[model samples]
Target: MKRGEAAEDFPPLSPKACILSSRSGSRMNSTELGHRLIRHYPFASESLLNERGIGIYVPPSYYRDENKRYPVLYMHDGQGVFGPNPFSNSSWNVHRTAEELISEGLMEEIIIVGIDNYGQERLNEFAHPLQSSGIPGAPDIICKGESYERFLIEELKPTIDGLFRTLPDREHTALMGSSMGGLVTYNIGFRNPHIFSKLAVMSPYFVRLDLNTLREIPFYKRYPGVNNLALWLDIGEIEANILVEHVRGVVEELIEQGFVFGQNLMYYEVPALRIPRRIGQPECDRRCCFSSGSRAKQLKPSCTAEKKSD
Candidate 1:
């Protein structure tokens, strides 16, 4: 039930192969729903540890409302976000869910960008650079996520912004992922408040709650360039249960650092469950996102307000 346990077992994938790897004919299922789920290959990159493909989900409104600029949500583990999982043959169906919400007027129109992991290197690339103590189940940081973070800020975001009609500001952009991906989301999202102002840290394996780790976190004071960030943090029953306490520890630290609940920071947990606002409702999206059976409007807040970098 650890972060990398389930998906990591897949055989190591070749970076070159992944560049060409993509789902069959459904490439860009220009669906009847009016939404287009497009998969583009050969997204060559040198800054990242591996060169890979990109999956872009353009909302129906993007096509319908010609002049509008949409917010962009960047997600990790492209395969699980919307397509069939190689391991379980299931998927997040994010495209369908987002479409429903937008159509129902429950959420704003937005674009989704999914980044495929390079198999084994996923853990290394996704590792958040923070280390206080070793996590029992979580793997130790291998590559320390520096390259991955660079790939996101330097190579990936710029490319995505250029090609798509994105808001291109911190407030209009978000970063999300679960488990290990969640850890890196905080590292990248919180650290780079000037770029990504929103974040969704679901079932993050914070690993070490030790004093040393807490001291290393830079959120103790109001960080410059991060004036108005809306953050969402949560965990579930099975896979996330093991790391729940650590998750709480991180939240407490954030709260002490001045992130107000119900305003900019929202934390949800239940030996039992899962945000609520029309613009960035976490509760509405919980069922739509975590539960396979449930559907939108699931609004997972995963972006940041743009700020001038210091």
Candidate 2:
């Protein structure tokens, strides 16, 4: 069996069982466990493309109340956002984290929408046309980020807002992802500031393209002010050396362009963990690192790190 294919056969595990297993020796009733499972819409079809659908994760409280409205965060790599799937070697477990945050009152109840990338077209769809230098044969790939963004803003958001009780303003909306997804979220958020006010980018794959001198992204020319937005950026200590340098360069550029610390933009760097060899195969590990960036945020200045074999 493939690494993530097992996710399909296994039913959603009860939160209580998971929690109880973690706790010393506590037992949880089935009814209590059922209540903890969030009301989620799996593979929700996009209005524009009926065949391609994104996963939706609503908080546990969403079903308990009808009048409550919540903030919405749109994330890329739908399969990796919540649990194991074809696209994820190790899931971020976002649902569990969000539930814990809500239970602890660290953050308000919010809705998470995970958008899946077109498997083969993922790289092309996520990259900006101007920045295509680092990617070999990048010209051969069709750049459709413009249309993809439109699908999110013009088609998907409207449908989601109409269906659920959401805080429809930009300030309450956030966009996030890791690797290429991170780069895309940054591109879209900066280009369409009126649509997204918060951005969470992790280990962004900015090296693949060279758009201008790196100092001037076309999006910056439109929205010069960064005060209106909140940004969270992070990277792992160990990854490909080139990719790490690329991420550092992007962060430095953002800082140079008026992204103040703790005010508008926040950056993090997490230490790398040594995984068992069985799960450390090249492709599987790539997704594992990307998924890990979503949950671990320990910011540090760029270090002189050695590169790992790809």
Candidate 3:
């Protein structure tokens, strides 16, 4: 096996064994009640940020087929993924959307892991001065994004791989998030291309930052072109004009660095998303194919805006 690749015939740990390894974690009900969502509460970390619960959504065929291994998508904002978000009463309905796509044979069956954000510390955990020019309603200073990165790459990924039957290679692994989470996904995806090959960055919080700030970001400084990485960048149609311009700027920058418009890079202006703050399930539905190794151009033209800009 390669550095990140998993053995095809490797056996998965029993659910009881998996739960026992994490002293602070508890296993919730599995496929017993037509529920495929698994919750591991207080998923303790070794030396990173505070421990938080994580939601893992196994595909419909996960439990039935013991020998099969699937790709994994690690998403931020776990609480709002499968269920309604407490803050806005809206959700991405990721599990529902994934099941639909898989049933229709639109994408491959994959595991979706939602990592919950630390409530008030979300900005501190997701935002970094090097990654952002400023975090609205918060001071523009250093943050613990590096620690957050270590938590995901070191603690979370390893734990998930050990517990689940996952195809843990870079090509099969992806990172996804919206807003601040989107910003960090973009940061982490490019910085560690060896770990993650796909990124779904919806409505990233680029704010009113200028190109100079974006150019100074560590990923841009280090990577001339992330052609090996697939990225999906988008914004709500009702969002502020500045945000649209910000995403456009980032798209242009990525293009300059060798990211093709309809190949590995995708930019969209989602008109169906009426609420600027809420992440739409349709967008999640569209991005499902990305995890299955589809190109960005395969997404619906109703949401894609690459031709207009080019």
Candidate 4:
């Protein structure tokens, strides 16, 4: 038998094993994974920014047509976007989700840019500089969110726009993530409204040590006047209530700042089981997640967002 055909010719040990082997044979490899993924890595020039690389997901059709321009969504927890790896138990299955969405035409074809985090510095980089009390075990580390934002706006965005035919306007730009990444989604969207018009925050880590400082964010003052911004906020009910409450507090502040519930903001609490397999890995025991958005015109709010507010 030929070397490539050897496996196909091998005798099966048992019916069950045969089935399992067949399934394993169909598994995707890294290159195959890359093709299935809209992959791109853009460099950053900011100092101390080691993980300045980003992975972008363009739908399969994106490669076939040169004239297509797609919306752009920036996601955090780069390693967790595609599949479970040795380093992470949970993944967003972003590639699979994007493929499905593109196939269904439910959403406009989009470009997903996964921003890899600098592990130890992730917490610091994602949190606002003034908000630091809630993050445990990192009292001395100063927040670098401002610098991180600069890297995205001044460096990453321009690079992505230049390389790909993306809709480079605020209405088409979005930010998303879970946990700390979720928090950053809200912070970045609100802080830089001109750049990001859509915000998706899943299971945000809002209970940081300095939650109080977020109240002073300037976006709060400018939110009401902002147009075309949509917000999607979802949280798991069984995860950590402290985090949920913190998210609620932030939403309240935004509301107080003049954002209408269902107009500029949409929030949801998803069950642990139904929580998208990608966002919470099979091993993750938490049962809920949360998210937010800015552009109301572009988003068709999910059913979960209509749930009663806490």
Candidate 5:
């Protein structure tokens, strides 16, 4: 991926979309809608990503502690994280899970930055090795994981750390995503192990699993410091046919490279999830496992934002 201009090159977000919604709402049952609020930033940036949206979730503890610093989890596919997906009309309810986990002391209060995917460019941005398309009007060149990774590590991470009271280190930073988002999460997180210490990839989309792709990663040779990195990789047994075999191959390769289970890696093959396209159940247990590297964790997104209601 090529380097681009600075933040000024991108357009500013819109007022309406950037509306900081109020978190002052009544609580609902866990199965009901997520009670946590989402702060949307429309037109967040188009430099390397889609100039569409950026959603942020702050955990409850953010308001209680003024001097505490927290870890950060960068998630892909912003629209599906907290709000209703226009297509599925369902969300992962990330906020609700975080709230419950934090209250129960099962998870540490952390920040979640949901990076939105571009419409037509979503595949390119999340492409692991620059895949191409057959549809008409599609660009002849069809890969963009590199540029997208740069956007997250170089641009987004810096801005977030500087703004939020965060533990700004690779050990404290994590990546989470499902499907295509999972694909990119694997790409970016592993490629920059020095930048991201943990990852939760759900049903990662890989058309094929090949050793060549694995060889290209430049794994330990580049960043040997994180060989013991924490990873949570999973796939539903009922997942689409294309994902099943590929996930296995990826896992096998990861193991060959010294990623052990229980110590630095966690892999699960379970029943179909509520929203197989996005995440697991609504209990927040899956969310907790993905964020904290421990099956025993969860979080609240209350980050560095000036605690205010919209």
Candidate 6:
């Protein structure tokens, strides 16, 4: 199956009408597994796009250490990340997962922002502009990716940095997403290297676009800000079967551009883990921390990390 084919078919959603549990605020109220999940409902923007929700997961140390600051991870597909997202009812359960990891000392404490996707507009917002070489099954998507990128960089990011105690530098910042979300994560990370240095692109829907067109994007053409990045790229066993060539093409290009596979750039193929949320379990979380301009750790089982030699 093409990436995000299942999510794209779901009905459109109005931002105000979705996730109505709380009001927009500076306070952190929601709780899961001893961590705070703050809900900023109807997070309005100056742009024409609908007002979306923001789910912020503050680490356990957030309250305990008023003087301490944590790194931030900005994630796409906000709704389904922290808990049962409104879309698939399957969530990344990031709150619980991160709590476990922190307690076990597997990963450091960081603030995770879940930026909600605009339901039906997800395909358009997350997609990169493709020429006539778009994939056969992929729809003709008008790339609002630039606008979405602006929302994260221009709007939401400043708000989070100002309100929360974040490191606020490119080295301490990261971006992660799955499927279509994954596609945008890589795009935004590459384009805005000064903003985010760590990237976890899980089951990226790169197969939706022609390999040649993808290679022509700025990161490939100019290689700007890529070397400063610690990128974790992965595809599911099933998805890998379909996108092996496309995924491999991107990996090979990154290698050619001086991304040492097991060191700066990490690539993996996970078996029996297809669901995007499940694909982002603790293992991925651990690697994300390892990628966050910190010491690298050994990868876990069931996930294959490939090292490419120049």
Best by the TM-score measure: 3
Clashes of 4: 37
Could you give me the TM-score of model 4 versus the true structure?
0.70
Estimate TM-scores for all models.
0.70, 0.68, 0.80, 0.70, 0.73, 0.78
Q: What is the alpha-carbon lDDT for the whole of candidate 3?
A: 0.71
TM-score of 5: 0.73
Q: RMSD for all candidates, in order, please.
A: 11.0, 11.6, 7.1, 11.7, 12.8, 9.1
Model 1's alpha-carbon lDDT is: 0.59
Residue 87 error, candidate 5, Å? 2.2
Model 1 alpha-carbon drift over 4 Å, by segment: 1-35, 131-140, 208-227, 238-242, 270-284, 287-310
| Candidate No. with top lDDT | 3
List the candidate 4 regions with Cα displacement exceeding 4 Å: 1-30, 34-44, 131-138, 209-228, 273-310
Alpha-carbon lDDT of model 4: 0.58
**Model 6 accuracy (lDDT, Cα):** 0.68
Backbone clashes in model 5, listed as residue pairs: 57-301, 58-301, 58-302, 59-300, 59-301, 59-302, 98-299, 130-143, 288-297
Q: lDDT, candidate 5, residue 269?
A: 68
As a TM-score, model 2 comes out at 0.68
Model 1: ten consecutive residues of lowest lDDT: 301-310
**Which ranges of candidate 6 are over 4 A from the true structure?**
1-35, 130-139, 209-225, 280-282, 291-310
Question: How much lDDT does each candidate structure score?
Answer: 0.59, 0.57, 0.71, 0.58, 0.62, 0.68
**Clashing residue pairs for model 6:** 80-85
Of 3 and 4, the candidate ahead on TM-score is 3
Q: Residue-wise lDDT of candidate 6 within 1-310, one digit each (tens)?
A: 2223321111123353323223453332343322344554457655425667777777766755689998998888888777777667677777667666677776788888888888888888886554444333445576777788887888778777766789999988999988888888888888888898899887777764347565322211235346878888877666545464566678778877888876777777676666755655645565556644445354642223232332
Candidate 5 clashes: the total is 9
**Tens-digit lDDT track of model 3 for 56-152:** 7778777679899999999898878777778888777777777777777778889989888888888777865454554333354457777888889
Residue 96, candidate 1: how far off, in angstroms? 0.8
Q: Across residues 1-310, which tens digit of lDDT does each residue of candidate 4 receive? A: 1123211111223432221122223331222342363343434345444544456666555756778888887878776665553365766666665555445554556777777787788877887654335334446556777788887787678767766778998877888877778777777787788888777777776664446554322111224454445677767767655565666666666666677777667755666623432454321211111111222233433333344433
State which candidate, 3 or 6, has the greater TM-score: 3
Ordered list by TM-score, greatest first? 3, 6, 5, 4, 1, 2
Residue 185 C-alpha lDDT in model 3: 90
